[model samples]
Target: MKKRYILENSKSLLVLLVLFFSSCVFAQQNNTTPIMENQFWKNVQFGGGLGLGFGSGYTDISVAPSAIYNFNEYVALGIGAQYKYLKQKDYYASHLYGGSLIALLNPIREIQLSAELEQLRVNVNLEGSNSNSLDYWNTGLFVGAGYRSGSATIGARYNVLNDKNGIYGSAFMPFVRVYF
Candidate 1:
């Protein structure tokens, strides 16, 4: 079990790393903001991840929204919120809700370093068993790195504080992001 877990994490990291590097090739180089000097609106960004899945016997849905203030091209600070729902035929159903505060650094146009503090609530209930439900709160710090370009980002993080049955499921998580 341990070996299989390690292998899966390795694969997830490898894939995220590849996506990051590929995006770097097309990283933006626009560093001009003479007119918008220190304008809050001009230095803000909004983005996050949205996910939807349907399988032969299950359904998944999620939404994460975030906002950032670019201190400069090299640094940013942000906050985010998330919600997710999962249902499996005749098995179980679960919901995850969370929020996070984030810090990011960009040494180059294509590479970014990320850090975040997260708090989440995970609730689970077996099908047709509304009377018996389990819920808990999970808090953790995550450090990660990613590749970023004009409007897209790919990254991975390992929870510094992880629990086997935690909201994240595992210490390792990979994410794809889009910004507007």
Candidate 2:
């Protein structure tokens, strides 16, 4: 009777081992790497804007360069730097240099919303008999939305913290953005 019991237990153990090995051989395999491991740099995008305006005695030239990291399809965070030179013949000339932090959201593929906080250092030099120079810092908060297509977005933004003595002429401004 003891021999029969040992034989029965051996058969059960053999069956269990076979089943386990078969399941392991037939299981799916995953070979993909995680986002943080090899995809961090792939998710970053770079873009910016260049602006120029000139008339009789007035001139404006600006260059803004920016970069953003896309957390996903819906959210992005970025930083930007801006430099602007403005001159009005025989009146005044100003140099504006600044940086901004920006946040972007895309609820869908065709629309993008953004908010940016900008801080600028302004240096103004007056021309004339009573010539004077001034230096100050200016801050602005802008909120905007745009239509997106491929790599380009066209939008308009309003500065919530606009002031009469600010660097921009108006609270409303149009923008064209491209990312790659």
Best by TM-score: 2
CA displacement after TM-score superposition, residue 101 of candidate 1 (Å) = 0.6
Find the candidate with the highest lDDT and give its number.
Answer: 2
Report how far residue 6 has shifted in candidate 1, in Å. Answer: 25
lDDT tens digits, residue span 36-78, model 2:
4457679889999999999999999999999998989999987
Against the reference, the lDDT scores of all candidates come to 0.78, 0.84
63-177, model 1: which lDDT tens digit per residue?
Answer: 9999987879999877799899998888889898988777888899998888877767789887777566888766767888889987677988878777675566789888676
- Report per-prediction Cα RMSD to one decimal: 11.7, 22.9
Worst 10 residues of 2 by lDDT: 1-10
Give the clashing residue pairs of candidate 2, or none: none
Task: State TM-scores per candidate.
Answer: 0.73, 0.78
List the candidate 1 regions with Cα displacement exceeding 4 Å: 1-38, 128-131
Clashing pairs in 1: none
